[model samples]
Target: MQLEQILRERKEDKDILLMTHIVLGYPSFEANREIIRQMVENGVDCIEMQIPFSEPMADGPVILKANQDSLAAGTTVEQCLEFGAEMAATYDIPFLFMTYYNIIFKYGEEQFFARAKAAGIKGFIVPDVPPEMGTTFLKEAEKTDIAPILIYAPTSTPERMTHLDSIAQGFIYCVARRGVTGKKSEFGEGFNDYLALCRKSTRLPIAVGFGIQDKDDIKALTGRADIAVIGSQTIRLVDEHGPDAVGPFIAGLR
Candidate 1:
C-alpha cells in the first residue's frame, strides 16, 4: 500500500498511529537495527531513519548530540542508506528518511532519490528544504515514487500552508511548536483549531511532531492528528536506559 493510504487506514480503524524517529548509527549501526526491530514489535506505525548531518538546525540538543556522536563514530551516508534498505526489506511498514538539504545536494539530488528508492525509502522528511527552493528535488522524487514530506510551523501563514500542501505527499508534518525538537510541548489553546486548519489546507495525512514525550501527549492528539511523531524523547530513552527500553516506552504510547 502507499504510505498515505496506510496512514489513512490506521486513522479509519480509530488507531492513533505512532511514528518513531531514530538517528541511523546513533549508538552504532548494529544497535540501530535492534532498536528498529524493537520499535516495530512495540507498535510503531512508521519509522523515520535520520541520516546524521553535521548541522541539524531544526533539531534540539538531544538530537544534535546524537548526530555529533554518530558522525564521530564515522557513520557515513552510505551506511545510513544501507541500514535503511535493510530495515525496509525486513519491515512491513513505511520507512522514511529525515535529513538536511545539503546532504542530498552534496550527494547529488537525482542520485540521492534513485538510491533512496532502491534502498527501500518510501519518502523523505527534509526539514531544511522548502517547497519553493526544492522544485527539482520534488520533481525527481515524484519520478522515483519517493514522497517528499513538507513541514508546517504554527507561525506559518495560510498562503504558506496552501503552497506547502500543494507539493507535500505521503504526509504533512505538522510541527507541534515553533522551536526545534526535544523540549516538552505544552499544547496550548486552539490546538484543535490549528489541526483543523492543516486538514483544510491539505489532502495528505497530518503527523504532528516535536516535543511529544509521554502517552498523555499521544492521547492528547487523539482525534486531532492522524499520527503522533516522537523523536528526541525516544533517543533520550535509549540513551538513559539502553535499547531494551525502546519497545516498552513505545508500547506505553499505544
Candidate 2:
C-alpha cells in the first residue's frame, strides 16, 4: 500500500499516526532489532530508520552520538539494509529510511534504491537534498516504487513550500521548528499558524516533528497534521531505559 493510504487510514480514526525514528546499530545490532520490535508492538503507525553516517548535520547531540556509536561499532550501509529487511519481513508496517543524500550518492542511487526496495522499505526522507537536486534520485525511486518524502520547515518560503508540496510523494515532513532535528523550546511562536499554512499548501499528509514531548503537545496538534513524529524524545527514552520503555512511552502519548 502507498504511504498516503496508510496515513489516510489513521486519519479516518481521528487519531494522529505516530512515526518514530531510530538509528540502526545505535547501541548495537541486537539492541536495534529489539527496539524495532518494541516500536512495532507499541502501536507505532510507521517507522523511520536512520542509516548511520559519519556526519549527521541535521540531528542533535543525542542522535549524533547514537550514529557515531553505531559507526564506531562497524555498522555498514549493507548491514543497515539487512536489518531493515529482517524487520520488514517480520512486521507489516510502512518503513522509511531517513538519511543524507551523500550516502545514496556514494552507494550509487540505483544500487541503494534496489536494495532498499527489495528490503521492503516504502519510502525515504533525504533532508539535505532539496527538490531541485532530487530529480535524478526521484526518477530512480519512482521506477522502483519507492516514495521520496520531502521535508519542509517553518521558515520555508512560499515558493519553496509550493515546490516541495508539488514534488512530495509519501508525506511532507513539517519540521515543527526552524532549527535542527531535536527537542525545541516552546514549539516556537506561531507554530500552529505555520502548520495551518502548510495544510493549506498541500494535500499530502503532513507529519510534524521536533520538540514533541508530551500528550499535551499531541493534543495541541489535533486536526493540524495527519501525524505526530516524536523522534528525539522516544530515542532518548530508548537510550535511557532500553527497548522495553517504548510501550510505556507510547502509552503516555495516547
Candidate 3:
C-alpha cells in the first residue's frame, strides 16, 4: 500500500501514526541498515532516510555530527540506495528520502529519480528546493508514482501555507518550531492554533515534527495531527543505546 493508505489504516481516534527519521549513512552503512530494520520492527509507519551531504544546511548539530560521522566512515549515496532497496524488498513500509537540492543536482535529477524508483523509494523531501524551480524532477516523480512531501514551519504566513497546501502531496510536514531540526521545549499554548491553521489549508495528511520527545508530548498531540514524526529523539535513542531501545521507546509513545 501507499504511505497515505498505511497511515490512514493505522491511525486511531487518539493515536497518531509514528514516522521516524534517521541519517542513512550515520556511523556506517551496516549500522544504518540495522537501524532501519530495528525501526521497522519497532512500529514506525514511515521511514525518512536522510542522505549525508557535505554541507547539510538545514540540519542541526546532532544531525550534522551524525552526517559527518557517517561520511567519515565511507558511506555514500549509492550505498544508501542499495541498503534501502534491500530493506524495501523485505519490508512493506514506505521509504522516503530526505536530502538537499545540491545532492539531486549533483547526481542529475533523472538519474536520481530512476534509481530511487527502481530501489522502491516511495517519496521525496527536498527541503531546500522551492516550488518556483518547477523542474523536470517534479514531473518525473509524479510520473513514477513517487510523492514529494513538503515542509512548512510554524512561522509560515497563511498565504504561504495555502500555497504549500496546493503543491504538497502525500503529507505536509508541520515543523514544530522555527529552528533547524532538533529537540526543544514542549508544545505551547498556540500549538493548537497552528494545527488548526494547517487543517484549514490542507486535505492531505499532516504530520508534526521537531521537539516531539516523549509520551506526554504525544498524548498532548493526540487528535492534533495524523502523524507524529520523532526524529531527534529516535536518533538519540539509537546513538545512546543502540537499535535495541527503539521498540521500548516506541512503546512509550503509544
Candidate with maximal TM-score = 1
CA lDDT of each prediction against the hidden true structure = 0.90, 0.85, 0.82
- Report how far off residue 72 is in candidate 1 (Å): 0.4
lDDT of 3: 0.82
For residues 1-254, write the lDDT of model 1, one tens digit per residue: 66788777766766689999999898988889889999999888899999999999999999999999999999999988888889999988899999999999999999999999898888999988888788999999889988889998888888899989888889999998878999998887766677778878988889999999999999899778889999999899889999999988988886
Error of 3 at 107 (Å): 0.6
Residue 73, candidate 2: C-alpha displacement in angstroms: 0.5
Model 1: weakest 10-residue lDDT segment is: 6-15
Q: Which candidate achieves the best lDDT against the true structure?
A: 1
When 2 and 3 are scored with lDDT, the better candidate is 2
Q: Which stretches of candidate 2 lie over 4 Å from their true place?
A: 185-189
> Root-mean-square deviation of each candidate, in angstroms?
1.0, 1.3, 1.6
Ranking by TM-score: 1, 2, 3
TM-score of each: 0.97, 0.96, 0.94
Worst 10 residues of 2 by lDDT: 180-189
Model 1 whole-model lDDT (C-alpha atoms): 0.90
Q: Is candidate 2 or candidate 3 better by TM-score?
A: 2
Q: Looking at model 3, report the run of 10 residues with the lowest lDDT sum.
A: 5-14
Model 1: CA > 4 A from native:
none
